[model samples]
Target: MTKLLLGRYLPGDSWVHRLDPRTKLMASFYYIGIIFLANNWQSYLLMFVATMVMVALSKIKLGFFLRGVRPMIWLILFTVALQIFFTKGGTVYWSWGWLAITQYGLTNGAFIFMRFVLIIFVSTLLTLTTQPLSLADAVESLLKPLRRIGVPVTELALVLQIALRFVPTLMDQTTKIMNAQRARGVDFGSGNLFQQMKAVVPLLIPLFVDSFGIAEDLATAMDARGYQGGDGRTKFRILQYHQPDIVAGLAMVLLTVGLVFLRA
Candidate 1:
């Protein structure tokens, strides 16, 4: 099973990894917007190609993106199946009683699945390239404008940083708990769906308790360090955009335009 990856940064010297964190963050948001605009297979295909280019630039294998998707594969498959079953339009390819699969449904399901894949790949690329600390800095910088409106940007960034930092830890905790349960003859993967869900309650209870315990420990550690708000705090590494960052921004702009044009 693929565990969740929150801020799993893979260090590299490639151009994608070298861009300023803010650039990557903004580009990610823009990419998400463009993805929602895609209404055709051609647009989604182009977007997937764009994502692959980023993967190549970041010096990561395509399998890296696919690996994290194992856990979600069931969800994706279910979603696509639901879309195929529910959507009613166009020619009916297969009919059984009141349940009919139409050409439109197949098209919609395929497009939605592609959209999901592209978004997942792009977001994973962003986190894989940018470190958690850098992401915090970028989020703080981006949210600075909201500070004047009484937004607690620093606190929000801190929450985000902590959440990202603990994703792997929580995943590890879940794995250990599951393993222990399985050893004791807990059938998490067998039986009917309801029975499987009942088995998960035991897992969730302990996981939540441990999560809270970890959160309390984190708070205590931060308090022990005399941590305060980011009023006058300075970063050890400063972010500065380079030529490659600008080029990447321009490329994103072009990609967005192309997706818009390609939308059916």
Candidate 2:
């Protein structure tokens, strides 16, 4: 959990690091949506290459991006396995009662796995390269038009940034809780599945208490600082587009066209 980097930012001066938050944020979402357009190996390969290129541009180690996927590995495999076993089409490689492995099932399973990895990699790239606060600004800017309909865009953005920022904090807190419990003779790793879950109960209670206390303290600090809601508030930093953002936008456009062309 501590090694997970999904919501954590790493400061760098790479090309990807310098992209406008709006570009990165929108591109991440846009890439995810276009992933569904991939139906065959050609399209998947193209998307995979594009994703890897973006990762390479970020100049972060591939291992860090991989760590982001590690925590979700089980879930990904379970889902891919379900798709393989339950989905039926093409040639039947094996069959037993209601379960069957077919050619189409294998293909679809591979596609699903690729989809999951690609999405996670892209998302991890966004969070790693862009600060949470910058993401909040991008989200607020993009959703500003919704303010006309009385939507609370500023508050929503604040919530998003806070959630992102707290992920690392909560992870660190979990690590501390585990360590403290371990010192008192709680074994987290040496047990069966049910036993491990039962052991986690001791960890969660205190963690929740601490989390609530932290939240309360934060709220008090905000109150003490006379922090009002985001209406008529000014930003300390303004987001601006640059050549890199334009390049990124164009890259996304080209990737979209390629995927459309390559989709089976």
The residue-by-residue lDDT of candidate 1 on 25-116, one tens digit each, is: 99998898878888887888898888888888899888889976776888999999989988999999998887789999999999888988
**Tens-digit per-residue lDDT, 128-208, candidate 2:** 998878888998999999999999998898778777778879988999899999999999977689999999999999989
Q: Candidates' lDDT values, in order?
A: 0.86, 0.91
TM-scores of the models, in the order given = 0.73, 0.76
Candidate 2 regions off by >4 Å? 1-7, 156-228
Clashes of each: 0, 0
